[model samples]
Target chain A: MTEHGEQREVFLGRVRAALGHTQTIVPDEPPAVDEALVRLATHDDDLITMFCDRAASVGMHVDRITADELVDQIVAKLVELDAKWIVVGFDSLDQADALNNAIEAADIQIVNWLAGGATMDVQFDTDVGVTDVHAALAETGSLICNVDAKHSRGLSLIPPVHIAIVGARQILPDMLDYFATQHDATGIALPSSQAIISGPSKTADIEGQLVTGVHGPGKVFVYVVEDV
Target chain B: MSASTTSLTLKGHDILFPPLPYDMHARADLATGDDQLQRFINNATLSKDLQRREVCAQTFGDNYDAMRSLAAEIKQHTLDHLDHYLEQFVDAATGTGAHVHFAATAQQANEICVGIAKREKLTQCVKSKSMVTEEMRLVPALVKVGVEVVETDLGEFIIQIDDDAPSHIVAPMIHKDRTAVARAFERELGSPYTENPQELTQIARNHLREKYRTADLGICGANFLVARTGSAVICTNEGNGRLCTSVPRVQVAIVGIEKLVPDMNHLAVLLKLLARSSLGQPITVYNHIMTGPKRKHELDGPEQMHIILVDNGRTEILREETREMLRCIRCGACLNACPVYRKLGGHAYGAVYSGPIGALITPMFKGLDKYPDLPHASSLCGACYEACPVKINIPKYLIQLRAQMVRRRITKWPDRLFYGLWGMSLRHPATYRFGGWVQKQMFRAKARAAGTAGRGDRYTDRGWLSKAPGPLAGWTRARDLPTPPSNSFRYWWKMRS
Candidate 1:
């Protein structure tokens, strides 16, 4: 090992030498990507059914509901968790006004958790988190949420229960499709933080016994709106 | 030992893996003698191996091997163009708001981290599961700097309090049972002893949640680094990883130089393979991609972020014929499939990384002379190759390393002299025939003297050598050795014709 260490130039220079390079030059194009091997679902597949089935398989609760029943179902679920203080990123979701009214009428206080990054104080006090997914993956039943000013990264995490409202139109055939839409012609555009959540937080650390709700939400409820 | 309010808590035993490679056979001997440990590790590895096969088959169907091939090509491509990608990644990450640092050694890596912690005056640290940090032994170094680093991951938390090293890659504590966890918790956290995994998990959760809420610094490891986005991708089943990156004011990710892929499309290919190959999950619970610290107008994220790209001994592997081994994703699939690893477990490998891949790269990362026994640890079994997601071809590299050992005169002289004479005998027909005839007659005479004569397969008469003489004695120490056939292949062919 070196006594102190090398600078970035010196370190990368050693890397170049190790790879049998005489001097730094333009690197060759990356390997040709074959999409046939990666993509699991396609346009022909029923993305909604596939997403629901696959999502349920990984222990997430998935329900197909119309726009009208969204309020009742979410309220019922919140009541089921006995949540008094909840966090909501409803401004980004469809039917945001009605949902907020119903949640407020149900007497659950909304806490702030987004600014200054996943405020553990509020997240720990909040019993449930509600948000809208940027995209829903059919191939693996994953929910993608990108962080923004309106949409906090903590609404789906740091709570005992997570309730997500996914638009049926947002469901993509595969994870590759989500990436295809996320990028422009120039290159892939990634948000500062994008969470692709699939299952409840769990661990098999002690003797390989599966335990749920270790640090993240114990239960994740994904409600797919049919006519959003 | 009697049953009472408190059952016998699992004894506290530290796995004293020395700084460098040591007597592996001695460790294997101790591990093989413990019946409970042997059975536990055997069942766990076997079950995990079965889960990987079934899940891969169900999810990918006939396209499984093709996906592995694609993933392998992507990793191999990145490694071939590592210098270029490294430059690209540094530029992209810096352009986004990440402070990227390079460390040539583990000490340098730790010092860089210590510098960051000291410069910011951050004392309390919350860390997620990171194999790279374990390689750096970052916890102790931070502790030495008066930084109270807390391991927030469940397995690592238990490991930290117990004063132990992780035994497996994904499931770090597969070697220890729940009783051991209960004991560790009761001893360290002053919690009551309970063998229930759920209760023990709750105990750890309650204990670590406080650290997450109060920590000023967060430490994490990368599963993949996307050069195009200049992002670090982490896939974790528990929520601790996300909490580590999101909860603390300052976030740092310690990544190996080998983890870069060109773009998100390439990341998709490898991510599909990593979790399914690891624990039969389609993906982990939280697959969070951090492009940089929290952006402008963003409410939740770290104020400052740093990426430490460590090259402790990787360039050595990169420059050698074993450069292909760097394609590993650290999923631990090869460990579950390796028979020697299944029997002896990871501690016997005597390195930060363990199993078939470890047996190859650990010796290369360190000197082959320091770990000469590791290459010979395998039965040349191809299970590890078959199970690998990135298609490492571990057995081939192991054979290459063994050949290197012989070429370097690392092999003992007595065995070398014996094998050299044995090779000469096989070059000529007369010496080969005489040697075989002499060997067959001696075994036959010995078996008859021992009165252990029996049918080879209930038809042909063959003796069982229950007791052997000289160096051969070790072969029959645990199990009997079967005698050779009555006639050689040449003689049999001549008789048939």
Candidate 2:
């Protein structure tokens, strides 16, 4: 067994030789970049309009509602989809009074993924999965979901349909803005996985024909609450 | 397990250059035989090209060129200080509870992966679509050691069952018709054959869902490795990438060393161009940035995370002239744009990488002698350069490879001698005009003998030469060689003057 230290040295040596470097060249300071960052620096377009337009273009259905109407909206959407059983992320628990009241009002069976003891089979069998987006990008109409204890990765993936609720303020202009604001606030490190889902899972692999719901959710709904 | 306990085992994983499964001319002949298949290839590439243009225009607006230039600059900078960035990635990934390993060759990479599986006592493995893993032939290596590996991506699943290689980079089964997939599933999975694409996808999903649920190991490839955060970013339209990374107890990512960006800011730049160029989507369904194993407080994710940085032939590509080939993001935009690729298709290339980028890098990665014909595959029309997201000057590299072949005497002696004579004639004006006059007379005689008069400058206007003498016969074989004009251009210019 070769030592990791020795292997590292040999690999770096080969890379240096290949690059024709006899001594380590210190990396120069990066430019105070101006192009993409500045272009997407601010949101001139209406966030709600831009988000809904981009989201709908990629096949995600979007609805707008105020925080006071959130419970009624959830109940209505669930009733409309005929969702009998659903799994919700723990991060949504802070609005438990409204969501729980809605779930009870709709008379649907629900499991909190963050509450623990939920198996993959249970998550897979659920009628719908719900989660809150950490941030949303209008440029690509993607929902950036960070996986943590409260937010299980499967909440947005395992079920055939995913419903993501995002605050109006969470919608950013583009991916550049999301990274600039999100990364500066939190350090450079990321979670184990951060999924930026633009739409329901889709594939055109078989004969170049488009098919949705291949492996992930087929139907995705985004409810951008106005007053969070 | 502690980092000290992890050991490097060097097995005999040297670069293995397999002979072409079939001859290029034979594949081209086969492609010519099936008109429907040819049309399929044509339609698929054409539609993808059109969609890419439409989406890129919509997404980037007027900033498309500027974004591509910035992307190219980012890749160039990362490659220039690759050693520094790689070291930084290693430190950061290790700090994030990921065990990082380096393999100098494909054999070593496979051995390292097998060693990890053996150590972890993993039995079943699920994989996402990773061209690097395909290049390394990782599945066969694992199966040889009694590890059952299932490809979870629907396209990869179809090809895996049929024991076929990928025909396209992003869409692996683009060459296959629905009937072929229906047949493969019926034979392999013992299901009723269905030609409906939706049914076929459902069949694959139902079949692979169990693998995702029960697999002990998950393997994937990174589209880009974030140097600042020690993250391996995978972009996929299907959510299999998420499943593969999140379901298995142990996950391993096999990444080429060239796939690196400085930070999240740079990652944002590449994210805009990747899907827009490949599949015409604003973004793929799932872009998973996996930093390490399941974090201390995380509920779901692999418990053990391993990253194998494979340097099979990338370090060699980093040297001097051919280094630009490493900037490829594998978007397959160039493949859709290349006229030769549209006609002959990926099978004719007979390499893991195909099309313009393939033509450029295959010779470098697999050696010039191994794939002597790849560089000649291009029409040199510069469409690939125009479509390239990173704007790799594929024509420049193709020309360089051809020159290297000529200098090394890898080309045939007759071709060399013919070009040599042609070059000498072109150097002197008198010889050039005399040679042209001789060529015109020969063509006029051939035209007259064929009972056709040479009346126009266009080759098609004159009678086609079904057969020709000497080196020109190859050209006449597939195409009609237009007879030269009765008067040379120099003669006409002389008369006018």
lDDT for each of the candidates? 0.85, 0.82
Error of 1 at A78 (Å): 1.4
With a 3 Å backbone cut-off (N, CA, C), the pairs that clash in candidate 1 are A114-B299, A115-B299, A116-B299, A117-B299, A117-B300, A117-B301
Write model 1 residue lDDT over A1-228, tens digit each, in one string.
Answer: 122446788999888888998776666777765777778899899989999999998889999999899999999999888889988886776578888888889988777554443365668777889998888899999999888878777778888889999999999988788777655644544688999999889998887889999999889999999988
DockQ of 1: 0.59
Listed in order, each prediction's TM-score against the native is 0.93, 0.93
Highest lDDT among the candidates is held by which one? 1
The CA lDDT at A159 in model 1 is: 80
Task: Report chain B TM per candidate.
Answer: 0.92, 0.92
Question: Residue B49 of candidate 1: its Cα lDDT?
Answer: 94
Model 2, span B185-221: residue lDDT tens:
9999998989999998998898888788888999999
Provide the lowest-lDDT 10-residue window in model 1 chain B.
Answer: B3-12
Off by over 4 Å in 1: A1-5, A113-118, A185-189, B1-16, B19-21, B440-471, B482-489
